[model samples]
Target: MRRALLAITGLAAGTTAMVVLKGSPGAAPVAQDLPAERPTVVPAPAGPTPSGGDTAGTPQPADSTASPRPGRTATRAPTSRPSATTRAPSAPRTTTKPPPAPTTRTVTGPVVENEYGNVQVQITLSGTRIVDVVALELPEETAQSDQRSEQVDGRYSGSSGLVVQRQSADVDTVSGATATSTSYKRSLQAAIDRAN
Candidate 1:
């Protein structure tokens, strides 16, 4: 694509130069930006040599090794032509798509402290759906508190747990574990909020 554009722009500039500097045969080349050297000598027009590139003012040779078409004669055609193997490129056709972002992630809520102990919750989510909940910490200060924490953890945290089944912090509180249950729900809500 780039080479084609350069070729086209080069030819346009060469045409403009020939028209503008018609009589000044020795003036600078008006062909497009060739490097220190041009790709090849393009054929000159039939009317007369452009003086932009073809050896200035001199009559160009009708016979040459570059292109020796039998009928070509007398015209100031350039000596070199594009090689046979060189072909114009076509635009690409494939479409590209980027991979999708990960949908499953785990989020941990801040540790919430209450009179009984500190409670922290973690939740795994698949897109907007809650997949599981886990109790990272709970009150282990006393035997009764430990049993209550276990009761709360068992009721609320798992793949098929009540928390996932309810999909919210509004699970039924255990009868004797009100404080732990409330703390657990608070931590779970915070984790869910952070995940969203």
Candidate 2:
């Protein structure tokens, strides 16, 4: 039969190479058969050691106070400890007075020509507060007078710059863009008469 099927496939490859060279019957113990011991070194004291002068290389407090010295690592002692009682020195602080300099200003107005064309406004201020009313020349000649001067410069220049900022340059006009709200309130009353 082909030499007995090649001798039963060489006896199942020599019994899987002798169970992979006879290894695992559990397997762990080999560091020179194991039992050495000597690592106890302790010595960490440093501060109050002048007592018996020759404590060799000083550092000995570890006889296992619940195991911490195998390479020395303890550190956490700062939970708020400063109260021996002498605290009477704190009264010198009254300085509080600095906030007045922003009267801001910026004017520009007088171009009022109109019939759907030259307006000009600017304003700004801040302290007498018109804050911001910018229309710097409006009616752009024709796309329906530039879409009715950008619909009264965006809905009556913010409600006529908050009514000429709380009624300052005397307010009114903006109804249906009444001639660009009376030439934007006569160029915001010549920039509120040059900001007073």
Candidate 3:
């Protein structure tokens, strides 16, 4: 096996060396010739050459009624015509929507008591829209409860409040703290009712 492997390695090295040396160094270099300049020759006009004027190959204005020169055909000028399919004039667009007029107000909710403790929330509104929801009180029966309440409140404080306000009291309860969510929503709904 070792001898076979050594033979394979030697074959690979020999193949690589042959490939590396395959290109011929004595190949002739390609010749790159510079482009030659050509003189510009404009064709003479069919009509009588203008005196002392260089109007060779210059375009002449079309004269449809004029007779064609000998051996040359007269070209007619193109006439403009209306399109076969005419588009109907577009109607002016109209909007009937009234502009939004937001009204800002702040209202506090009634305290809601659940199995954990009392929960109360204060809500800020702009017209019928709820702008912000703040917790006035939260359940904290024990030290652990207080810590859990703090963590839950921090997580849901802004985002959860916005959800409840926009979605109303029927929003989904927060995971791992259903009781807290229920109590908070109850209090928030009361506050929203007061604002309305």
Which prediction has the highest TM-score against the true structure? 1
The lDDT, on a scale of 0 to 1, for candidate 1 is 0.84
Q: Candidate 2 on 42-102: residue-level lDDT in tens? A: 6667577768578766666655445555554444445896588968799999998898888
Backbone clash count, each prediction separately = 2, 4, 1
lDDT string for model 3 (59-172, tens) is 565454777555445554567877888777789899788877887787888998877888888767777767666787888898866765675566445645544445465666
Q: Write the per-residue lDDT of candidate 1 for residues 38-96, one digit (tens) a residue.
A: 23345555686565675655645434445544433333446798999998897888888
Off by over 4 Å in 1: 1-102
Q: Measured by TM-score, how close is model 2 to the native structure?
A: 0.26
Off by over 4 Å in 2: 1-87, 107-117, 131-162, 166-177, 182-196
**Model 3: pairs clashing at backbone N, Cα or C within 3 Å:** 103-127
Best lDDT among the predictions, by candidate number = 1
